[model samples]
Target: MPKYPAREPLVLLPCRLPASLVARFAERAREQGVTLSDVLRAHLTVDEAKPLGKAVPRKRAGLAKVSGADPKLLRQLVGMGNNLNQIAKLANIASKTAQPMAMVELLITLKGIEKSLEKLSES
Candidate 1:
């Protein structure tokens, strides 16, 4: 099986179309070396996939314009409040790992955190 970047799962979206047009659209997508989803996304409002060059400036300006800003850099700011809570839990686990039971617990905690980080980073 081919591997792809770990991304958000595919969401089923409903659309109205004649059967013939839908079949033709699918065929055209195959000929163009892309999936039907790719064709749909190209013509749809794909906000998340906007070019980073455009996104970065817009996000930065929007964030900076807030009266209370600057505690964190732009990249750090998105979804950051949740990140801090996760980091604190990790540190607490590490600090309590001197004894054997504590060490095992810490290992489990660390593993769970690793998986969570992998999911978030992929996003």
Candidate 2:
């Protein structure tokens, strides 16, 4: 077998997910020719926030309605794409400290923050 970079140890988490969802993920993993662990690892390795899509011009009235959200917050959210990259790098480091669980929590918290920002932008 060809050698590859040594992967850091992972702690198998017992997630209380719906059986159907679990089975779906398992099937997807199989279709991708990877183990479930590989699928999760790929997810965990994402280091950047991706754009929702191409920005579309809004009507003046619609823009006014969305402007109710704080301008600074909107700017931060618009610019937060790079921030997620940094967070992922930190998560990679945190993986080595025997506190990957904490790192995962941090990643989830950041995702929630990003989602909330998107909600505001969509309004």
Which candidate number has the best TM-score?
2
> Any idea what lDDT model 1 has?
0.67
- In candidate 2, how many Å is residue 53 off? 45
1-123 in candidate 1: lDDT tens per residue?
Answer: 234468957689987979897788799799899988777666565565566554443335455577456645555545554665775676677677645666566567667767766786787
| lDDT, residue 24, candidate 2 | 83
TM-score of each: 0.27, 0.31
The lDDT for every candidate, in the order shown, is 0.67, 0.72
**Any residue pairs clashing in model 1, and if so which?**
none
TM-score of candidate 1 on Cα atoms, chains taken together? 0.27
List CA RMSD, all candidates: 14.2, 16.2
